[model samples]
Target chain A: MTPSTDAPHSCTRSEDELWASLGSPPDAHELQCLTCQEQRRRLAPLAQAAQEWKTGTDPEESLLEGILGRVMHGIRTEIRRGTLFTLTVTPLGPLRISSYLLLEAIRDAVDSIEHVELRTHKIIPHADDAGPISLAVSLAMQAGQDGTEVAEETRRTIAARFAERIGMPIGTINVTVEDVFQ
Target chain B: MSGPEKPDQQQLGNLVARAQSGDPRAFEKILTYHQRGLLRFCTSMLVVPGDAEDVLQEVYLTAWRQLSTLHAPEALGTWLYRIARHRCIDHLRKRTPQPRDLQGPESLAGDIAASDDRSGENPESNAETNAAMTDLRRFVHELPANQRECWVLKEIHDLSYADISAIVSEPIATVRGRISRARTTLAERMRPWK
Candidate 1:
């Protein structure tokens, strides 16, 4: 039977055959196929360039640490203008849900105080929506002076909002006084 | 196949979320978790370590500003990897060729621009080596941009074909084919080395 170009290569033979054709040399098929032969002809310089792009640990650790520390410090300094117990919220995180509800609660918590700032941080995942949800949130606050009196008032207002506004159950709504920048 | 507990990815997702929520400590944790690996990846894709460092910092800043835009939380590693690869491509494009002058044989830094040969058994034989490299780059680069996309995503980031296809917006078969072809092209170029 005359060999046909259209004949499908056998599965058992194809992978090794193709990889071999490329890896080592042009066998009968590759030697004959113009595309494969061309590729075979051109492999040297690139392999050389790729090797030149070597990875080395010659990088300075201080360079990375310095940049990160500098940025973090700058952000912290600016944030302190408001509150201390700052939390960053992950998207779709429990603290995110709770913080939004808390904000709405405070939004309704009697207009005694003027301005407020809240932030959530640190996430711990919860399998069944437990206390933490793989994320930990820190709440940074910039709020008016209110001791136990305001804290309780804030809680009640937030709880009411959570019940009314957020249909889903929320995790923790940690509250902390970041700053009282007068 | 992701099992129920994608524990590693899950943990990373939580850390990112916390950092986005403005938790400094959580952000710190995220850095600690991925920093070394990220650096290594950047170093490999970019020719110079300096460019890698600069790009790595840019990635974090971009991530911080746009953390909320991460649609799927567990894919943070993959997302950062994508950013890293794009930045490398940008770096590659901006590079200007320097006049070739042979630095003495003793200098290890020669490896950076030797262009002489990947394995410089003979530096004078560079023309053949450079031609092969150029051709390899062309053939691999010629792949449908999507195939090239998949191949690079897989090769550079160490992402699986499935992950590569997901990132490149292609079917897994396409990803596999691209990768196979990429390897085939590279292998053909480096047959002597093999």
Candidate 2:
């Protein structure tokens, strides 16, 4: 007979030999030592019982959902606490814009990113002084009824534009996709 | 599973970036991705469903609040597990009705924590196994407290002996001994299923 898929935690051997030892094998000095045989004999039922206990308990669906909800809600609550925005000035800066306009655009862009809980994470410059700064953007997206990829692209696009309009050239535009999600 | 695996690194990385910068949605995605393993570890270690859930929430909240502290993005699984283990231990300590000790010395009292001495055998004696399971659960609970805990952490949870030793602040030998005896006594008590 083919061996059963499940194994006793103790046996650590083949079934054929396990019972074979029951008939003929080594003695206390040879193998299958008397105590080992007796121990195996004793442990047979408990191992079976453990397998049942392991399979018996099913994870709670509602409990898992509730835990996930609490975690996600906690993150959202942290996001809403305050707005932390990053500003990137490119080599191709318009150079003559009022500082007020620049700040306003950035603030507005920050709002746009956070509106959907996505935002400008890092500003990666291509060179020591690359023109149109390369923006390394991170978007924390919440997948809505809208498809996940669609939401991600939308967030990425919004972040890219915001980086461009912040009165600076954004080069090497790259999105460090963190989560595709939901 | 808490959330489906993203399967692609680019997507997960993007979400992580957004999360670090205050994008609540991105952080939430990460949370959903990792909740189950954390919960499972907690449930197994705590040995109580309710306490496990409570620790799960606390662990996640702490994970969020301290998210920025984690340096390795890919090591999130291991990091979260470590935190879960710590939190469960704390929760268990609070709920366990006993004095504080790292690992109580091994004694025969530890041997018979549950009872039974090798009568398990034959299909007809299966009832012995059933009773042992119930007894084993409580027996471990009645262990010298520390040895009981060390046994659970090392044997049942499949955590490393060293890890169990560190968690209980006991010597590795102590950890191994307790585990060996815990299994020994339990095995002798319920030997038919072997």
Candidate 3:
């Protein structure tokens, strides 16, 4: 593009051309021209301001912290959303619940059972094989409580809760009494 | 691209390594380090300060989830910037941004244009410079998207043309031309004040 044809006060060369030259070695005309010198002088403050602007306009600290907190919450939500299982009924509809939420429900059910402390639980879903979910739960029984009865009670409670809350039939509820609490 | 190691890059690389290894605090460090500049760039692109912060938060979230996928840790600044740029552009295209008119109190303008103390000027001259810088910043928000991006990335961040091109996904020649044109426009706009 040609420079503006405006006379002496302004450079005949376009700013684009002048800027392009600034990237390379100084031109002989640029060295001798008064207008080009003025252009350079004009650009200097802009460049300075640009550098200063980096540290100048910081967002409020609380805003940054709030954003970070939101982002972290979003990450957790995404993780929860990723592990969601879709349950299909005969003709009713499909429902979505996170595997984590399902596991928590199981833990709560088992813990509420007499003399049983739920340690951990895992839900295994075989969507490809169209198999029912397999739940394996570990629990600690009170020393006076019968292990067999408590294990049986834990299994029954988990199955009932899974059916009631998740609305999905379970293939098996494997309850293991790993520890006996005094 | 191998070169002498910059101190900041070295620090960033270490932080990125820790963040990739599941350190949330390290990730926060990375976020705080780049937030200011990214906010400026995004604010320029989206016009509204609030939108800019939202985009930056999204940028950091994406970065946190995808940190392991970033192959080159040394280019963390550019990578974060690239993400912010895309988010800002997407944000701009999706909806109308409320224009942030320069309506803040005149006394507060100097606070927003706090000097970096690099120029070693007296308080009076520095205040004047700060006021002028504030005006230039306002003019920047009024600039078209591409030119504003090119100018802010080049001037404020001191990114090389190559880096700016990669972040904005423009050719180096195009980046140069945009910056030059932007400077010309800015010169004409500021001429009256002089």
Best by DockQ: 2
What is candidate 2's CA lDDT for residue B131? 57
lDDT (Cα, tens digit) per residue for candidate 2, span B1-194: 22476535645555555556555556667867767555655655665547778898899788777778766566565567667767877887788544322224544455454243443434345475555555555455555545655555544454676666655667887776676555555555554234
Ranked candidates, highest DockQ first? 2, 3, 1
lDDT of 3 at A17: 61
User: What does DockQ give for each predicted structure?
Assistant: 0.12, 0.22, 0.13
* Better candidate number, 1 or 2, judged by lDDT: 2
Q: Which residues of candidate 2, in runs, are more than 4 Å off?
A: A1-31, A58-62, A84-120, A123-135, A138-182, B1-34, B47-49, B95-135, B144-178, B188-194
Error of 1 at A122 (Å): 12
lDDT of each structure?
Answer: 0.50, 0.54, 0.68
Residues B12-69 of candidate 3 have per-residue lDDT tens digits of 5555654564445566667766666666677777755577777888788878878888
TM-score of each: 0.47, 0.53, 0.56
- Shift of residue A132 alpha carbon in model 2, Å: 14
**Residue A154 in model 2: lDDT:** 50
Docking class of 3: incorrect
